[model samples]
Structure formats: structure tokens, C-alpha cells
Target: MTIEQAIDSVKKGCKAKFDSTVELHINTNLDVSKPEQTIRVSVVLPKGTGKKVRVGVFASKNVETAAANLSESDIAKISKGELDPKKEFDVIIAEPRFMPKLAAAARVLGPAGLMPSPKSGTVTEDVEKAVEQVKKGKIEIRTEPNAPLIHTVIGKRSFSTADLAANFGEVMAAINQAKPSKAKPDWIKSVYISTTMSPSALVDIPDLA
Candidate 1:
């Protein structure tokens, strides 16, 4: 199916009571065992993710605007298992100064995938900008640890077909741009679009710009 048709198909197949997320999955030709062949980057969708992101910040300097601002003491508590970050925020951003302090909590945060890292734009000096990006649909797209698959959400079932298609295009464009220099032209083996509980719809690979 074309991208638009697949988006519409998935949207119609959604039976969830809530607005189900429209997810994009891609099977690639990359060899994940090679560090250079992995895909790990954050992208801001043009049409947004159609879901609100709860952003938390950890910084030495006070950032009143963060959804859940954590101090050095709070970091200590999280490190010691006295705090459960999963319950507090959907995304976490940290200032460079607080990174060392955050290491103690990596055991708790790393496995959860909420530990801030410069690679994902979740660790920075501009905490407010990072928060804004996450709130505005910035998402991390990465291939599976041992597989050649990439999975991430594009938008929601409630979004218009055009909006979903646009977001999908942006994701494909980003993936293409991030292709490993030595990868084959046909690096993307297959792509699928689906809703939270809907059957996946195979999609024709859209032409890359």
C-alpha cells in the first residue's frame, strides 16, 4: 500500500478506547553488530507525535519551567532507588553539569531508556530548548540491539491522513539521511505502518528526496 493508504488503513483498524499511536517499523540491511551501522538519533516530526510529552529536567541551576525539576538531592534519592523516575515523567533531560551525578542512577534510568544523553539531545545546556523539542514531538529512533529493525511512533490514529503521511515522510527522510556511508542503496528492506492494536500494513517505500 502507499504510505497514505497504509496510514488510513491503520487508523480505521484501531479499536482502542483511547487515541492509539500510529507506529512506523522498518527492516533495514544494516549489520547491527558493527557500531557504525546502528541508527540512533532524535528527530522532531513536522506534524508532531499527536501526544503530550511530560518532560523532566535535572540541573544544578534552577529551571522552574520543567515539568519535574530534580536537584542534586533528588538525583541522590533516584540513585538509591528512593525515587522511581518512570512514575514522575515521560522524558528526562539533564544539564551537562549534572551528568556525573546522574551516573549513580544510570542503573535505574538506562534500562528505562530515560537517561539523558547528548546523542539524543536530552543532555544539554539549553534545558528549555530540549524540553520544548520533546513537548513538540521530538522522538528517538533506534534500531534493535541485535536486529536490523527500527521502530518508533509517527503520530496518532486521530490525526488526518495528510498529517500522518507528512510525519511519515519526515521519518523516512531522516532515516535516509542517517544511512551509513558504506551501506547499499537498498538499505531499507521493508516498512510497515500500524496502530497500537491494529494489524500492520505493509507500505511501498516512499521516494526519498
Candidate 2:
């Protein structure tokens, strides 16, 4: 769907009330064929979604030192497979050549789908930007268990429906244009959207179609 359609869909399908905080979940085709390719995007809501996400970076000290990328934060550290990957973080980052290192954490991260992958743009020179995105409401998604889950905050309970809809549309476009390819059956199996401490409501992916 184009950006316009995304905006329209969110406006029509939104069910949250005026005094309710909520989020949006989108499922669509994305472009991720090239590791170096930049994912062009814009935040409809200038203030942007507010969600605290953790990032897990796995790299050799040499590799970690080679680049003056992002400063390592508590959330952006090593997460080898031996430990509980899910508990470690939400997103995973690693050197493109060292995907094998992720094998150990596969069992843990795979199920939760936090496995670091070059195809997903986790192997990037702009490590700082990658981490910063997570600091925003950017979500970590995978194609194994489900088609593609794009979770992002819409707004607080105080936001107007139109404001929330615009934010939702931008997130939809981001998810749709994230990877270059579409899922075999479709990019979405199901969708559930909600806020930080609220319950999610089922949203039909067809809204975007």
C-alpha cells in the first residue's frame, strides 16, 4: 500500500477511544535485499513513538573497536547463545561475517526471533543509528514463527484519533518498505496493537490491502 492508503486505513480501522493510549501493528512487503541499502522513512508524528527497546550487540573486541560506531550501552552488549537471548534484549546486532557466532544463541533468540542477521540490516556501520532507532519505538521482526510483525507506539491516551492515525500510517509504510520482498503467503499472519500497559486488539491485516 502507498503512504496515502496506509493513512486512510489507520483512520478507518482505529478502534481506541479518545482517552486510551495505543500502538499499531502493521504487516507489509519490505525491501531488505542489500545490507548496505538504507531504509528511507519519515516519522509522521514529529515527536515520534515512545518505546524503550534494548539492543544486543555481538562482536569481537577487534571488530567492536574497528568502528567508532555506537557507544556500548547496558542494552547494547554481547549476547552469546549460552545465555537466555530473550532476556538479554529485543534486537540483535553482529558482524555480517560472523553470523555463525549467532548460532549459539539461535535457540533462544530464534524462537523470540531476535537473531542478528545481515539481511535485516543488523550488520551495519551506522551502529549508533541502529541503536538509536531501538531507543525510539522501532521493533524487531522476523519471518519464521509469524509473517512480519511491526510493532510501534501510536500515542498516549491524550492524543486525538487523527494524530494517532497519522503515526500509525508512517509505521505501516516503514514496515511495508522495510524488506524488499513480500512473505510467501503474505507479509502478515495476524496483528495485535495496543499501548504500554493496555491490552491489544486484533487488527485485520487486510486493512492495508
Which structure among the candidates has the greatest lDDT?
1
Best by TM-score: 1
lDDT of each: 0.88, 0.51
What are the per-residue Cα lDDT tens digits for candidate 2 across 19-126?
444656554443335332223333434444543456666544433322222223322233433345467566666665556555644566666766665556676656
Off by over 4 Å in 2: 1-21, 25-47, 60-82, 141-163, 175-209
Give the C-alpha miss distance for residue 183 in model 2, angstroms.
Answer: 8.9
Cα lDDT tens digits for candidate 1, 1-209: 88888888888888899989999999999999999999988889999998878788987666666778888898888888888898888899998998888898899998888999999999999998888888888999988988999999999888899999999888888888889887888899899999999999999865433
RMSD of each: 1.5, 8.1
Worst 10 residues of 1 by lDDT: 200-209
